[model samples]
Target: MFQTEYEFTLPMGYIDADGNLHRDGVMRLATGADEIVPLKDPRVQSNPAYLIVILLSRVVIRLGALEMINPKVIESLFAADLAYLQDLYNRINGNGTRSLKLVCPHCQQGIEVELDQPGES
Candidate 1:
């Protein structure tokens, strides 16, 4: 898988009594190409809020910044990761779901359908 690394400096104002933010003075990290591409695209790059959310997620995961472990944050992160994975899978595999399973709305019986090959007619 392709990957890229980026370094960013946290501002001084974020330091707190608990500890200094980045006592080492530099934060360097790697993210998958799939994750970085969307952020780099000019169409979406101008939005700082989305960038902040992505940066914070990376910081939280890389720095192990849990003061008190919140399950919701963990769940949110997991969901974000899963969404990224699903996007990557769709791009690489040519479609999102390889197969579909259908069940009766009332009785919940299992049904299965297989997707066509990548270039199949």
Candidate 2:
């Protein structure tokens, strides 16, 4: 059976204050309130983009040796890692396991693309 939570390795790991590199982690599928409740946060209201930062912090249950998963950790992550997680957040929550329907730009051929893997959009 499939699991609601998924494990992933960052393309570029998060380096903590102690200099330990954390590449392995797990994130759960976002619930409706997970996305909605953040809108009321002052941080989100002050800066719209901060939504993703907060959202990720909430869903990422574990990351390496870090006991506290907060926005600072998410913000400190490499751009590639952030992209990787965002793609994952959208994929699992957006369409489950089904491939997204699309058409080739050059060939104009219809295609089905699966964005199941981390960092794949």
Candidate 3:
């Protein structure tokens, strides 16, 4: 069976009004409508960057103990967390390999590391 949902951990995490920290979350593959609908949003129209917030809100099904995820929630994310989500969104939705290229500092050798989404052993 094909997998559409992916789990991830934020580098910094989100802190709620109650002082709760949310790090782990799940994001599903984005549909065409997810991409298209955000474009029509007035906020996205005013600020193109706001598109990611809307798009992410649509795809992120869960975040820690939060019962709901919305644009305001996404907007409240730290910059690092938002960037992490953006990369995750591109990686899964783009159908690209979940591998990252790196160069070993000690050996000065190139290597590729396969990234496993959270919840995987």
Candidate 4:
């Protein structure tokens, strides 16, 4: 058996007519659930986001499992899921414009620190 819980609030923003940010409002995201069954397939593990979002929709919206498994949801799932994946990729590829590791000169011990910019200490 597997179980997890998450709770957070999403702040709302607006877009101007020219597509600029408008700081305002607030929104809440919440979920409550009991037991969760784990997905046991190795192939699904490779791209687990699709399965994850389906599970989320089913549990959050109380929608039928079949509706959560529909094609349109899966399509939206990929794009929605890519945000985190892309952040991971950027961090790995050193494209994050920040570095979290530094080396000591004398002892050569690896020190972990975050650099604000490419050349920042």
Candidate 3 versus the native: TM-score?
A: 0.84
Residue pairs in collision within model 2: none
Model 2, 1-121: lDDT tens per residue?
Answer: 4567989999999999989999999999888998999999999999999999999999999998899899999999999999999988877776446577999999999998865544344
Tell me the lDDT of model 1 at 19. 59
- Give lDDT tens digits, candidate 3, residues 1-121: 5788989999999899999999999999889999999999999999998999999999999999999999999999999999999988988886556789999999999999997653444
Ranking by TM-score: 3, 2, 1, 4
Q: Is candidate 1 or 2 superior in TM-score? A: 2
> Which runs of model 3 end up more than 4 angstroms from their true locations?
95-99, 104-106, 112-121
> All models: lDDT?
0.42, 0.89, 0.91, 0.37
Top candidate, metric lDDT: 3
On lDDT, who's better, 2 or 4?
Answer: 2
* Candidate with better TM-score, 1 vs 3: 3
Candidate 1 clash pair list: none
Cα displacement (Å) at residue 29, model 1: 26
Give the runs in model 4 whose Cα sits over 4 Å from its true position.
Answer: 1-35, 41-43, 62-74, 77-121
- Residue 22, model 3: lDDT of 98
- Each candidate: RMSD: 16.1, 5.2, 3.7, 12.7
* TM-score for each model: 0.25, 0.79, 0.84, 0.23
Poorest stretch of ten by lDDT in candidate 2 = 112-121
